[model samples]
Target chain A: MKILVIIPAYNEEENIVNTVTTLKEKCPDVDYVIINDCSTDRTEKICEKNGFNYISLPINLGIGGGIQTGYRYAYKNGYDVAVQFDGDGQHNAEYIHDLVKPIEAGEADMVIGSRFIEKKGFQTSSMRRAGIGVLGFVLRICGGGKITDATSGFRATSREVTKFFSANYAQDYPEPESIIAASVSGFKIKEVPVIMNDRTAGVSSISPFKSVYYMIKVTLAILIYRLVGKKWR
Target chain B: MMTDLFRMILLGGVLIYIIVIGVLMKKGKMNLKYSLVWFLTGIVLLICAAFPGIIRSFAKLIGVYSEVNVVFFLGVCFLLIIILSLTSIVSLQSERIRSLTQTQALLEKRVRDLEEKNEVH
Candidate 1:
């Protein structure tokens, strides 16, 4: 399958190159694109110097917009599958195949890489895990399936999903929301076990105080999607 | 009971507001799509100001004790509708802007790739 790995980077100059280099060494044949979200830092310069394939957005659209740009590229370029790999060093490159296998086999429309399924690697903090657990329960009850990791950025989607996301996607903190969108739109989702590493450099955009808001907002977003009863497709 | 001078001031104020909106529309400072709402609002207010008896009867029909309350109610409702419509407009414009940015970035990369291929040849 023609798979495109999308790396959404925002002010990730410290980790972008290493992440891309690791992906190149690990998955040599897979095409990849880095979406530079108008970083105030030198992330774009590093990509240019390395002769990496990237799109530098004119303005910052946050993570959701950056990923949507990648989906658009994949759709327009006739890619059969698109994998979302974080530009930060948190996501391991070796497990990318595990996420894509289901999509390639036509068993699933969207495949999410979950850390909780295997209970391996950096499992995140207890507080964050609790929040993720809450989101998982909410998705299971409302989204009609059990998604162990609703917040996992490491995922692969078939061309149908790539086209859907290219036309419409949530703006900020869209990981959980996108899952809800896919499920309500009648796309089958699957989860595979994958080990994740703690971000080696740079701070996460979500701080301790914001996590509470994130949980509340994401839960409300998922519930609204379930209740809206609109034909998303 | 409003004095004659107060009613005259209200009439003049609404007239001036309508004229200003018309001037803005003519100068292209405001889009016709948006100006139509404001213009209609101004006209409604002008009619109310010109015929105070109309408001008094409507207020009476609605069981409102004071005619001024009717004026305030209509004003608030009009403003609320205008604000809601503006919010929808902004939401649509932002979506369009995002799509434009993504397309522009993709096209720029395609051009760069073509240029590099020419250079290699």
Candidate 2:
């Protein structure tokens, strides 16, 4: 199967090289693209210097739009599957094949790599884990299946789901909202066990002050997707 | 019991508003699509200024005690509508810009790939 790994980087100069190199080393045959999301740092220069395959967006499109661009690229290139691998070092490269297996077997349309599944490797702070718990509960109530890692950026999608996301995607806080959207649209969703590393470089996109706002906004977005009811399909 | 001074001031303000809109349109500063709403608002204000009794009667029908209160309420409603429509326009434009950016980036990658192939050949 033709698989494309999309790495969306935003001011991730500290970790982008490590992330890409690890992926290249771990999965030698898998094609990857680094989406340089108008980074203010030397990220674009680094990609250009390293001769890595990358796309530099003209404007800052945030996380959702950045990943959507990757999906668009994957669709245009006729890839059978597209995997969203984080530009940060948090996500492990070895588990990529595990995430892609279900899609390759034609058993699932989307597969999320969840650290909570095995409760192993960088379990995150207790407070954030509780927040993720609440988000997962809300997602389940909204009929998004039992996704333990509702906010996990490590995931893979089948070609059909990739096409769907390229056409329609939420702009802000898209992870939880997209699961609800896909579930409502009748796409099968699954989760697999994967270990994640704590961020060795660069701060997380979500700050401590913004966690409350993020939770509220993401909850409302999930509920809104449920209420809207399969409009994208 | 409207004062003549107040009525004249209202008429003069409406006239200036219409003239400014006209000037903006002539200078191509305002798009005709968006300026239509402003023009309609100016005309309504003009009608209200030319015939004070209309507002007075409408205010009375709406059970508002003062004509001034009616004007304030209407002004707030119009502002809300206009602001909401502007927000919608911004959302549409941003979506378009996003699509354009993605397309441009993809095309650039394709061109780079083709150039590399030619150099290797």
Task: Give the true-contact fraction for every prediction, in order.
Answer: 0.71, 0.71
- Tens-digit lDDT track of model 2 for A29-101: 7999999999999999999999999999989999999999999999989999999999999999999999999
Task: List pairs with backbone clashes in candidate 2.
Answer: none
Q: Which residue pairs show collisions in model 1?
A: none
Which runs of model 2 end up more than 4 angstroms from their true locations?
none
DockQ of 2: 0.80
Q: Give the TM-scores of the predictions, in the order they appear.
A: 0.97, 0.97
User: Model 2 chain A, poorest ten-residue lDDT window?
Assistant: A224-233
Which regions of candidate 1 deviate over 4 angstroms?
Answer: B1-3
By lDDT, who's the top model here? 2
